[model samples]
Target: MKQNITDLSVLELSNLIKSKSISCTEVTDSFLRHIDDLNPQINAFCDIFHESAVRDAKLADAAIAQGHYSSPLHGIPIGLKDLTPTSGSTTTFGSKLFKTNMPEHDAILVERLRKKGAIIVGKTNTPEFGHKGVTDNLIFGKTRNPWNLTKVAGGSSGGSAAAVAARMVPIAEGSDGAGSIRIPAALCGVVGFKPSFGRIPDVAGPFSSTTPFFHNGPISRNVHDSFIFYRAMAGEDHRDPFSIPTNSSQPTKPLPPLNRLKIAYSRKLDYFQVSADVENCLDATIARLSNLGYQVEEVDLGLGLDVEECFMTLWRFKLSSTYGGLKKNELHLLEPTVQQLISEGNKITPAKYGRAIKVRERVWDIISRLFSNYDFLVCPTTSVPAFDIDKESPRRINGIEINSLIGWFLTYPFNLTGNPAISLPVGFCTSGLPVGMQVIGQRLDDTRLLQFSETIELENQWRS
Candidate 1:
């Protein structure tokens, strides 16, 4: 039987389109139809532009017929997290405050994706202002895991991850701040790559110049697909001053054999709590790496339990500084979690924020030292599998009280240190939900990270 268009990877679909064996319209229709059938229950997308998507796909088909193949993303249907602004489209940052807000220009990544011939299908849902780790908001409700409806899809890229997991799109744009992209990718059993800071120019909207922890990235079912998106979006734009100005994304050297690579493994990043099933899956993954002839050794990161405290300090301040100017009525319209964040941000003194910066430097020192000895660091992406969709985050893990905000998150430290990290769906929990294994590389070494992840993807053949 011929495989469904929606089931094929981005490269597969691109080949089919490039060869004229299948038109872009057919592929777009397949995905739109699939979205029509599945999106109601999954609630992965807050907006679906059926007419414009078909129009764009038809344009792509016309271009391909004229012998124009833009890139691997050509003619592919992709979802943008609602937080990503699209010119002339309603780009609600998952908050009612911006429900009708439309931008006059696309975000740098969005512009790049379009220039590469990728069609934007619609905007995926996200938590209000993407302030939390769960995908629930006043505007779009909650996005549920495609693996299990009762479980969350993860956030703030939850909608993008869920859309990719459900095969509604082969790949989608996701942003990571405290693992927003990686968190959802892990929960939805997809690949999410958080490139080293500024690998992808993020110049637009309120965050155009303010934050460094936040990253614009990609989510897909496999590493190769994510790599394609990364290459298309990576590179410096004059607009984002922090954007890395180099051709470092292109790999210059071939990868060394797996046997020659040393991988550092940590089950828990110090004080984080992980559930039993996730722990088991993580152990099995490490053993698989060992059996693959890779030297995998357990290590104590010694990041200390207070890591989350410092992270929250920086996060809250960012939130407060960004949205603290809202009028009283506007504040009430914001998500309670976001309002709380702004309130918390107000309490953060300049000295406390300064301390957080010092803590970030410490994190960088520790992770940098680890990378000096090991080629990569591997760990569970999230401390637990998907949890209840309605809750902001789990109050406890393994029956122990944890911080409700980001306590279960194991991804923020890398974000803090601006390391390149990718999440691959390694295995499943006892309850049949997926578990992700995170791979971290030295700063600005995104190319090597993708190569390593592709190796593992080939070995394990993970798919949503």
Candidate 2:
């Protein structure tokens, strides 16, 4: 009967529930208390399902009392990113137009969660349609960082990252098209895992079917909970053509031996200029991992990765293809930034988008060759630490101009490469703000990534 159980990892809580040390109702109540008290300031949740969550918790407790256990996630509370739809819950997608949107059925991932008996706590906020890097949206205002409420939590999975960092929920679902999960995780000081594309099947809305960039992943305070939650939701779904069978690719594989690891550590990944504070912090983390005999070495990507042109071209095309066709009258419903993005997207030529696709393939080839020699690749997750919540994004970095809101992020290139990447809280800046180091694994080798990440986590002792 710990009074402050909100901080316990999901695995610990699951064990407690199994042993009857704490009823599911009690677990639910502890988090609800935190949500009621902290959520007002964090703005992490757009909707909190207190009544339904309690009902579900009681059901979970009764199941356990009857000598039954659904899964490790049973009785564990988690938040679904607003981009995902859950039956009987508002799937706002963090948009004003969909403010009253409620889906008749849960997304495939949500259905899997219910099967695992996870308690659905609420919907975490996101940028409308997960458009930008920063988390603020017109529908529900902004989600602030828990580490320092004045600083912005990176997005479009901003709410999920903030909620996990704030301990509003032990785990929250996050979607990444272009560093949506890793960006927020880095800013908020949490573990955000974006499994290799297709590892977790997405809802695959019309536009989603057209691209392979979007991913459904997990955000949490630790590696163990993330891997567990990922296993529960990861499997083939008929609805998602891109879905991979869990049996064919076990994300639960054991960690490889440390002596066998040949990791590539890059400070800037070749193009971005990392802030002085962030660079210093990453240098310390790399040194620590080096001393631990991880066989790490610094290497430049050499791939001319101001990849903004190719990536953003595809981004605009994706946006235009997805939102450009929406009825003209409905355009007013979007936030101004998103509306502007859609407008720019509509202007992209088919010729330009095609060239960008070719560039993406070339980028993947380069990364693939590098992975052939390295067990893992590491770098600072974002070039800068968390910025002000009031601004759209850092307009400049190291006195140089940034092309877009996401220009400062180092996590997006991996998104383009379809690699399993993660953000682990490594160190804090002079102002006490957290900095994250990104690690990417071979394509479809998520298990190895988590194993290596666990090693790094143990070495660094990351705390939000």
lDDT of 2: 0.87
| lDDT by candidate, in order shown | 0.88, 0.87
Top candidate, metric lDDT: 1
Give candidate 2's error at residue 223 in angstroms.
Answer: 0.4
299-418, model 2: which lDDT tens digit per residue? 977667537788877777777777888887799888787788889988988798888888788779889999889989999999888888876577788998876577788877777888
lDDT at position 193, candidate 2: 94
Rate residue 429 of model 1 by lDDT. 94
Candidate 1 lDDT tens digits, 1-464: 19988999999988888888999899999999999999999999999999999999999999998899899889999999898889979998988898999888999888899999999999999998787788988888989999999999998899999999999999999998889999999999999999988888874542533344788899998888888889999888878877885485565566678788999999898778988889999898888889989999999987986678788888888888888999999999987778998998999988988888887888889998998899999989999999877555788888999998888879989878888999999989989999999999989888888999988888787752
Query: Candidate 1 has what TM-score?
Result: 0.97
Pick out the ten consecutive residues of candidate 1 with the lowest summed lDDT: 203-212
Off by over 4 Å in 1: 203-212, 249-251
Q: TM-score of every model?
A: 0.97, 0.96
